[model samples]
Target: MNALRTLISLVFAALLIAVGAFPTGAAAQIGAKSEVHTEQVQARLLAWAPQGVATGAAASGAPGTVWVGLQITHQPGWHTYWKNSGDSGLPTELQWTLPPGVMAGDIAWPLPKKIPIANLANYGYEGTVLLPVPLIVTPEYKPGPLTEAMDIGLKASWLVCRQECIPQEGEFALRLPLRSSTALDGGAFEAALKSQPAELTGAQQVQVAGERLQVRISGLPEAVRGQALELFPETPNILLTAATRGDAPGPRSWTQRWDGAVWTADVPLSPDRADSPADLPLVLVTDDGQGWRADATVSGAWPAPAPVAAMSPALEAALAANAARGAAGGGPAVAPPAAPAAVPAGTFTWALLGALLGGMLLNLMPCVFPVLAIKVLGFARHGDDRRAHRISGLAYSAGVVLSFVALGALMLALRAAGEQLGWGFQLQSPLVVALLGTLFAVLGLNLAGVFEFGQFLPSGVATLQARHPVVDAGLSGVLAVAVASPCTAPFMGASLGLAVGLPAAQALALFAALGLGMALPYLAASWLPAVARALPKPGAWMDVFKKFMAFPMFGTAVWLLWVLGQQSGIDGAGALLALWVALALLLWALGLAGRTRWLIASVALAFGAFLAQAIGPAVLRGAEPAALQAQAAPAAGERWQPWSPERVQALLGQGQPVFVDFTAAWCVTCQYNKKTTLANGEVLAAMDAARVQTLRADWTRRDPVISAELQRLGRSGVPVYVLLAPGQAPKVFSEVLSAADVKDALAALKS
Candidate 1:
């Protein structure tokens, strides 16, 4: 019951936050003319008459209609869509709230240009464009006192695009007084009206001819008889919007031929077509911006609809909520809210550099230290064998590179299959965590000389390792990556984040770069004769050195156990500890005499297998619901609170500064920060002084919400530090955090 309740809470919070988490790019005070600005565009609501207008004063008389235009000014190279967005975009939407009897007409869409990105063609407007909507004042509206004015509120949303897409919105309220009209903005409105497509009085027909859509029209303007005309379909999914080859403005999207008076075109229909209509609506625009609208009868049936692609759970829920909200407000459904994908911080070259540097730095992290120490011991063991050292180094480098590529490929594949995942996703599973802990324990025991595999194995099996010395080094590289990848180094966060959004070939290249970087040090040590000479010669003290290195492996195992405790609670940790004792017994039994060894090994193996079968599911599946919630909660008197999208948004809406720590227990870097800088009293005092709400987003478990939020910020792992102030862009901190970094960020938030 508690589990079900927790699920319900998560669902409700996700849906509720979807309404406002990514809403309204800008805010403004209500007025006769209101303007809101985003990074890429400016949106303004303007009345046709700037000064007040009295009823029945104009020649048309008696307060019939007034025009209000939503004007959008785009930055160079950016554009917003028309009523029907072609290929891969969403159309702008307007929802109005007005006084009784004042109804709003649909937007008077202007002529759209074919804006192309890569090979996809989009129907949208560039530069500056005004969408005019008429407000109809019915007889039911009565004139009030002289001071009375009409109040109109509008919520507008649009998707702007260049190389990437950004979804933005604005809320505006306008108050128009009852007085005389000045008509100051009349020219803008008139221009928009002139740009509107003229209704066609010509013969228009459409037929589905196999895989193509055949459209025919006649009675165009005489001047346009021999001129090439551009076709803009009003109804979506009727024809392919992407070109057959090359980018836009190159080859014509559709084949066009004019036979003197009549115009005819054969365009391939969309393979993923989702709509079929009896009437086909299209707009034909000429070179001079003059356009004609045609509503033509269809003569044949559309092809069978293609299977729809699945949506992410977050998107699916957001769409459902949008539909519900639209029904409640009695308006058309608006576009779903979206987190603006932050443009990658740098270019592909920079990303590759970051990945390379990040991988090199991973050698310094504690989680990876144990593996490096073992590799150092191996180098010491083979100090006199230069050829062997070089061969082992090559094998190790190959292992690291191939392992990183395989892991990167799997992550990409899962993401393509609609899983909201990120780097270090493997650590989210308790089973993987348990298995890694056991593997480390075995390594620690071997290093400590508890049992050697060769002592018990047949001569044939034991000699296999002696025959292939490089295999051991290769396996060590794989083990290093398995343990170290979770500790996201400085540049790795951004590089990994950007990688997930890039093309497969490029993304995998970045991953391979990271692996190559990690292997560089070992390769250099093996290849450089001077570096090898610098190493201490092997001696009796080497055994003690090896034994000392065993402690780090044991330490790593203990840390993994702590991480498991965080994920599955104390009981699960205890269960694993019991399994470890059985494992130790089996290892010890291998060193005993024949009969005793067999007898004890038999008992130990049976006991370990039984325990695993009985408690493995319970431990690996994680803690009970109550325990998980309790773990999520902050301890007594702690300033930090558990994070949710709604919580962060609610605090921000109240003008509160918020600091979010996107972290996980398995992340070694995250644990270090939590123990050091984040726990500092001075940092806490500064945050409290600024009244910043501290939120801890625990990603110890698989959390789709946190994963989605991370992707939005262009990060694939923790610890991600985000400082957000109301009405300001978010400030993201580096992965290697510090006390001074916190204080500086807080101080800036105050400033």
Candidate 2:
């Protein structure tokens, strides 16, 4: 993009240098560049009005006639949004600066496409397009002898984005003859252009209900699908996003929606052009998910009738039979359920604020409290040394912020790739659980005085701790917090949620915000003199307190192991337990073995791991997966299978109305939904009464199948609900839910 900007700059310089060539006239000494090139951009975008458009000047420059053309071309991968950029973005622009006596009409823009890019979606074109802008000549305007040369100039600007956005600018110029009218080629370029989306004759205040964007596409047949249907608004922010359901409308003739809508209609979706003008591109997405390319005029009802024989035999026969039947009996039956009025979509800001508040509350959580205490005590111990205290606090803060920033970036990257992840995703990994388990085991051993660091191999006290005891406390504080990484509050919850939807910078900012919130208490403790004075003195009893602190780490390790067992099956649990045992035995041997044999023993212990692995996973496979049946089932809804596209498809094949809930046990939002919405008696009754087969995709653990399915639906996180009504295509809901919404949907299906 920078290279293109440089080239654009150089071209402008050349154009300025060429200004001296213009002829001097009596009234006005006009100056203009004959021709110029736009920036040599790196394939991000290149849109232009083609000169190949048909020219139909009755007489060259006769009366108000003038030569005009369309020569537009766009780059690959790169695209520019239409008038309405949708959600958040601006459209392409071209400012005409023509010489005196020469004027150009509004440039005609062809249809545009709405392309999905990670969290945000954009509306633009992918390839070259021809936009025809007619040139108009005033009847009295006459070119003087010296100023016969005419110049056309344009200042173009567009927003380009791939992973990040770069604003591009350029100057396009065209030279023209001074004749009354001149002819220009308009065929080869004109044929390649796309047409605008079908629009209503004029602005219509349409009523939206549920997933239906009800506009009167009058004179159109009701039973349209695939490339035959779609909606585009002419109002700003009215249609923030596309709808989430339909093709199988409750009763209406047309309904459409995207995957982000929760529970069908209680939550209103923003129209497609949320942050910009509605007068923009609205490409039609066929029912089959194919693009609806333009074929003809943008002004009247689309698509001239095909030849008489173009109609399908089945459809034609049905129509004929319907006509005969209507003549013999009556009109076809009409069923229109009263659609609930449309509602407004709330901002991601609210969710952000919630996440922030949650981060603040998280400071009070038990898992975090003990760690904070240790951190505070360390500060108190170093209270007399204020500089060291500040450094420690700042180091801790840096570590926390760094951790959250990394996590936030990872979330965004995964989401962009279409993976549905959730909070505590690390906890879902058996390896992480095992590693944490091992860490805790080590911490416990340290507390048990099994061995000592910073001291002689078997000494009760560290060899260096006698000189640097404070160093140990600070290091311990860091590790304690590390061990508590999985325990995040609801505020961290929403920030992570928004992080997935924002640009990397904004996401990192939010992540850093949460980290600051988490570290604020520690900082306050350090600065508070009263808090510093309340700590116990450094003495023999310090050992006891340290040992007592080790117990929490041990317990935490045990909890991690259990979580691992559930995640990795029995074998993983066994392997982890075995690994801990091996470490303990080896350490004990080291403490007792003579120097001559110590090296040999250590080598054997280390090398033995490979031999154990060669013996197969069975040797270390824990006894956990087998034990799961004995444990009470997780509180998943009645009969909801784990999320699997194949399983959901099968359920649909069985003609059962399947409701697949995508959730993770570790996600706070998921837990809230379970406790309040899905677990509610009313929702349960409705589930049973409606005969809805429920399927749960437990994203609590990594499930490749669930992740792929989420990508298929254009989502990368949980709290996704898929409603596959009997004999209809599946529809997705959002991150939130309600019992009434489900009930209404169930009732609609029954009818």
Q: Using TM-score, give the best candidate's number.
A: 1
Global lDDT of each candidate: 0.73, 0.50
Model 2: CA > 4 A from native: 1-353, 364-370, 455-482, 592-751
Once fitted onto the true fold, the runs of candidate 1 whose alpha carbons sit more than 4 angstroms away are: 1-346, 623-707, 714-751
lDDT of 2 by residue, 1-751 (tens): 0112122223322332233123234102111212222232322112232321112222244434343433334444555556656544456676777655546776555555656543334555656555456556554355555654456666666655433233455444455555433333434324433353344243322334443333332322233422244443333344434333345644223354432311012213342222322233234444443333222112222222223322234333444554555456543322221222222225445644655566566677766654665565565456477666666666666656666666667766765554456555566655445555666676566556764433223343334443544444344444444454677676565556556556666667677677667666676666666665677566676667767776766776777777765554444455556656655555455555468347754774664454234321322222231100111122344354443455555566677788877765333345456557788888888878888888766543334445556765666666677778755546766566777787888787778
- Weakest ten-residue segment in model 2 by summed lDDT: 625-634
- Candidate 2, residue 640: lDDT: 48
Model 1 residue 390 CA deviation (Å) reads 1.2
What lDDT score is found at residue 382 in candidate 2? 66
Lowest lDDT sum, 10 consecutive residues, model 1, at 624-633
Cα miss at 150, model 2 (Å)?
95
TM-score result, candidate 1? 0.42
- Per-model TM-score, in order, reads 0.42, 0.38
